[model samples]
Target chain A: MPRTALILFAHGARDPEWAEPMRRVCAAVREQAPELRVELAFLESIKPDLRACVESLIAECWERILVVPMFIARGGHLKRDVPLLLEELRQRHPQTCFELAPAIGEAEPIVQAMARHALALASR
Target chain B: MPRTALILFAHGARDPEWAEPMRRVCAAVREQAPELRVELAFLESIKPDLRACVESLIAECWERILVVPMFIARGGHLKRDVPLLLEELRQRHPQTCFELAPAIGEAEPIVQAMARHALALASR
Candidate 1:
């Protein structure tokens, strides 16, 4: 059993198709690292909201979980909403370690990849 | 002067720092392809709205522009708001060619990079 889980947290949209890309990212992450339990959680309309995702993982005896925000950058939601949710989850599950990872988009490699994609697209 | 320009379109936020990553991508694209004019345009709460950016580029005689959305997925903002804005711009500048590139996040390599980042973060 995997002791650690990686949760991709994103701002969900009203349109169902909006989650398609995030789902693809989830699948890709799972394929790359099958050792870690991976799941997708949404901040809004999409199912398996953060709390629910954490609960399910905790039930599976996953003691440590890292939440990686998939936002393009740090914004009001990250500044205001996320901390509260994480704090509440911590209170709800004192035994489980629910850690907040850095904003995924802020990663240097990720930024470089986006830049490359933009440049390539522009060229095309 | 570059005949083609690339506009990285993003959903802006109230926080000034929210656009940092998008700005970095813009700068990286500029560095990668100095021949193609690259810029950042925001949908809200940021400077250089799409119209103003497009207008300035037109003034500079840049004839072709490719707008690449920095959004993670195709949502209501993209489906409803962007097309209308692009259409308005096209009408305002019939001579200019304003093309929409696929969403940057939906790009295959970008998705793979994100997956790799997630796994890397999970391991740490």
Candidate 2:
């Protein structure tokens, strides 16, 4: 059986506080799926860029890796940069399978949840 | 009683399709809360920047406006840029009150939703 890992990739920010929400999501995922190894990575201004994070997982003999973009939209970072990074990762780690998920904002449940949050705030 | 509006403020991208998810969220909010007026605004690379959106609302005689940053985290843009924008808006429209909500990612429900989405994708 191959070991699988999930990486919550996000757009990094200069303020350290910026990573809090993604960290919360990562923690929640870890709590839900204890068997799988989970990690966080960033595009810029943060530690463990995607390449480095993937390399670390590859070294750990993880056979399958899922990269989930923790973004509100599939902007330039997701559409142009992420795919390019994934292509490079594929070339480097041919044996390890890398799968990219759609941006979290694109998920229906997430969108609905956001709408609920907005409604709650608006009502207050 | 003064009319209230909800502004879904997001970081716009060069690619127009990137706005789809935000649009969906906006539509869902509209569907759920038909009485409240909702609008979408961007930080950059798109039309109707935050200033313009708020100005339009002020002109429309909206008394209270809620600006929700549809970001995954409280990055530099949120911590520094957003406040500055809000301050300027406040100075210009003292009659119209403005309130800022936590980024969508900070909301517990939104975070849990992202985690669930990640788990589903990782399992597949």
Q: Judging by TM-score against the true structure, name the best candidate.
A: 1
- In angstroms, the error of model 2 at B51 is 1.4
Model 2 ranges with Cα > 4 A deviation = none
Candidate 2, residues A1-124, lDDT tens digits: the string is: 4678999999897777888989999999989998879999999889999999999999999999999999888877787788998999999889998889888899888989999999888988
The interface RMSD values of the models, given in order, are 0.9, 0.9
What is the C-alpha lDDT profile of model 1 across B1-124, one tens digit per residue? Answer: 2378888999898888889999888888888887778889999999989888888888998888889999888887788788898999899888888898767778899889999998887887
Interface RMSD of 1: 0.9
Clashing pairs in 2: none
- Enumerate the candidates' DockQ scores in order: 0.87, 0.86
Model 2 CA RMSD to the hidden true structure, in angstroms: 1.6
Top lDDT model: 2
